[model samples]
Each structure stands twice: as C-alpha cells, then as structure tokens.
Target: MKKTGLFFGTFNPIHIGHLIIANHMAEFSDLDHVWFVVTPKSPFKAKQTLLGDHHRYQMVLEATQEYPKLEPCDIEFKLPQPNYTIDTLTHLQERYGDSRQFALIMGEDNLNGFHKWKNYEAILEYYQLYVYPRISGQKIAEALKDHPKIHRVAAPVMEISSTFIRREHKAGKNIRPLLPESVWRYMDEMNFYR
Candidate 1:
C-alpha cells in the first residue's frame, strides 16, 4: 500500500519554507510521497492578492522537480474554485483507492479554524491529520485534542513564507536566498509578480 501525504496551500509562489516542510514530513513520517496540492484560492483568505493558478502551479513544479519524493498536484484545478479540503480528500480517496492511505498535512495555525471547514468532523474521521508547528500561539495536541487521527510532527519550524518573499520582491529587494536558484531564475526570466 502506498502512503500519500497531501500538503494543501495556495503556494502563491512556492518557496523554500514549503519545500523544507514537505521534505521534513516525508523524511520523518511514514508517508511514502508528499504531494503539493496547489490550491487556486483559499476560501479563508483574501483573493485580491492571489496570482494566477497556473503560475502558482508551475512554480511548485519548478521548485520541486529536482526532488523525486516531492510531487506537484493540480487536482484542484479540475475541481471547482474555492476548493474545499474535504472535497479534494474525497476525490483522492475514490480515485486512488483503498490500497493507498492519504493523510492531510497542515500547519497548527489552520487547526484553530478547522471547525469552520466544510464537513470538518468528517475529515477527522476519514483521514489522519499531520500537524507542523507554525508561527506562534498554536500547538498540535491542544488544537486537535478532539480528533483521534492526529499526528504531531517534529519537523523544524520554517519561518520563511511566500508572503515575505513576495513583499521583498515587490519592494525591489533580493529574495534569492529565500527560494531555490532554479525557481528564482524562472521567476526572473518571466518577471513574475513584478
């Protein structure tokens, strides 16, 4: 049976922080592969700032292509916009079948609002939750105390984020160190988000 880890995010521009966490999860957890589920637009966030979906998807592909364990997924692209996590999970289960087990990889910050997710309780019942440490004021055990299928990962907390990189780039500053050299070159060649 193949164990798959689904890491969901807008990935406005895939950066080092996202890759580090995915790699960390694959290295430390029982997950055989980590898929970057590049969401078109998160319903929980403001939409005005989001880049084109294909652009974000390509960025993920470019950043993760070197790593065999990392895969960029566009599952949400075929689905409706403002895609729900539970819906994607359901689709994956039906498409991938029972021989494969799928787990949801998320930051502790999102756990606090987990209740607001569509069919949130059902998600807990159906899939395991892999939690990683986020900025602050979030703990895996405390936030997901009610959910039995929860796994608190001990991966390093990456403070870098695409938001920070985008801000720096927009400000005419350097973001070379914040992302992979290949990704930086791709963004530079295309003059993305400038």
Candidate 2:
C-alpha cells in the first residue's frame, strides 16, 4: 500500500514554521509525501480578514517548491467551501482507489473542537490521524486515546503564525524573517497583503 500524509492547513501564506512542521512529519512518519491542503476558507475562522485563496495557494507553491517532500494541494479549493474534512477524505479515497492510505496530520490545539466536525466519528474510523503537539503531548494523547488510528507526535513547535506576520505587514514591518525566503520574495514582488 502507498503511504501519504495530508497536512491540511489554511496556509494563509506558507511560512517557515509550517515548513518545519511538514519536514518533521516527513522525517518522523511513514508518509511518502506531505500534501499541504490549502483550504479556501475555514468554517471555524473569521473570514473577513482572510486573504484570497489563490494568492495564499500561490504563496504555498513558492514556499514548498524546493522541498520534494512537500506538495501544495488545492483539492480543498475544488471541494465545497467551509468544506468538511470527512467529505474531503471520502472524495480522495474514492479518487485514489483502494491502493493508497492517507493519514490526516493536525495539531493538538485542534483536539478540543474536533468532535464538532461533521461526521467526525466516521473520519476517525477510516483515516489514521497524526497529531503534532500544539498544547502538550500528554493532553493530545489523552484526548485521542479513544481512537486507535490517532498518533500524537512531538513535533518542534515554532511560535509563529500568519496572523502575526499579517499584522507586521500591515504595520509596514519586515516579514521576511517570519516566512520562507521564497514566499517573502513572492509576496514582495506581488505586493500582497499590504
């Protein structure tokens, strides 16, 4: 069977922190490729301030181009907006046939609200979940203990966020250090989020 991990994120703009997490997952997990599922819109988040989906997707492309392990995926964009993970998983499974197995990669912070996801139980039943520490490893493990397919990993946490970077950009501050050099250059060249 082919092993693949889907690192789903809004990726408002792919940054170094996101890259680090993806790299860690690639190194530690049995994933052949880590696909960055660039979400068009997240149902849980406030959408007024969100960047355009295509711009964010392009930034992800630039950021992950050098890393063979990372592939920027727009499958979610093709799916329904405010899309449910379970529905996306179902679609992907059918599209790939029975030969491939995909694991959902997430952070511990997502654990609290995971139950709120549509058809959450079915998602756990079919796809294996690889969770990175967002709060604490023990908490993650405890919360996901009921799911046999869930694996909590101790990925290095980089205290960086796209929100912080966006704030800096709006304030006319340098955001180069917060993002991958390629993303920074692309953002600058395109004059985005200013």
Candidate 3:
C-alpha cells in the first residue's frame, strides 16, 4: 500500500514554510505523497479572517506545481461545513480502501490540542501521526512519547507563520520571502490581505 500523508491547514496563502515541511515529510518519512488538505473552515479558527476556499485551494495548487509528490486536495469542500479531521479521515479510508494508507502530518503544537478534537482517540488508533517539532511543543511531546503510532520527525522548525505574513502584507511590508514567487505575484495582483 502506498503511504500518503495528509497535511491539513487553512493555508490563508500558501507559504514557503508550508512547502518546506511538506517536502521534508515526503522525503524524510515513509510517505509516498503529501497531500495539502486545504480546509474551507476550521472549527477552531475564525471564519471571517479566512480567504475564499477556492482562492486558498488555487494558491496551494499554484505553489505546489513543481513538486510531483505534493498535491493540493479539496476533499473537505465537498463535505459538510465546520470540517472535522476524524470525519475527513473516515471518508478517505472508505473511499481509498486498501489501495492507499493515510497518515496524519501535523505540528507538535496541534498534538497538544489533539484531545479536543472530535473522535481524537479514534484518530490515534487508526492513523499514524508524523509530528514535526514546533515552539512550546516539548511538553506535549513528552506526554505522548510512549504512544506507538506517533512518529517524531526532524523537519526544520520554520518560525514563519501565515499570520505573520498576512500581518506584514496588510502593513504594506514585503512578504515575498515567506511565499512562493508565483503565489506572491498572485496575492499582489489580486490585492489580497489588504
């Protein structure tokens, strides 16, 4: 079975940090492909701050065009609103069956809040989690250190954040370094985050 990693995010605008981590997950881990699951609406995040789902999805596609192993997925768009990770994973498992094996790629910060998610335990039981380190994640990592399904990845922790990028752009500061050149141009031409 082919191992695919599901990297879930809002991706207000696709950035270089997102690409780097996905590439690291694909190259350094057992994943054959890393799918960037662009979420339409996250339960924990403010919907008013999000860009249109189609726009976010398109930016992800444009940013990932050069990487054969990186794919931008719109699976959640067809699902119900206020998307839940467990439901998405269940749908994917049923749809793919044994043809592919799906794993969860997440930051260590997310792991700290794992218990708050719907069917969080079920997620732990069914899918392997590939966790990349993040600032302030050491405590959570220590608590789950003995979990058999969790694999700690050594991917570089980039301090760049979408929030920071958006803030910079809104302040009329250059954010080109944080994003792919094509995505940067798209954001500029479209007047995003203004």
Winning candidate number (TM-score): 3
Between prediction 1 and prediction 3, the one with superior TM-score is: 3
> What TM-score would candidate 2 get against the native?
0.92
User: Which candidate should be chosen as best, given lDDT against the real structure?
Assistant: 3
Model 3 / residue 91 / CA error / Å: 0.6
Please tell me which model should have the higher TM-score, number 2 or number 3: 3
Model 2 lDDT tens row, 1-194: 87778988788777898999998988887787888988887888887777788988888898888889888889888887788888788888998858778889988778767888899888888888888877454354354666678887789977788888888897999888889888888888888779
In model 2, which runs have C-alpha deviations exceeding 4 angstroms?
A: 136-143
What digit string (tens of lDDT, one per residue) describes model 1 on residues 1-194? 98989999989888899999999988889998899999988898888888888888888999999988899999999998789998999899899976889999998888888888999989998899898888887554464776568888988898998888888898999889988887898889889777
Cα-based TM-score, every candidate: 0.94, 0.92, 0.97
lDDT of 2: 0.84
Preferred candidate (lDDT higher): 2 or 3: 3
Q: Write the per-residue lDDT of candidate 3 for residues 36-128, one digit (tens) a residue.
A: 999999999999999999999999999999999999999999999899999999999999968999999999888878989999889999999
Candidates sorted on TM-score, descending: 3, 1, 2
How high is the lDDT of residue 49 in model 2? 76
Find the 10 residues in a row with the least total lDDT in model 3: 137-146
Off by over 4 Å in 1: 138-143
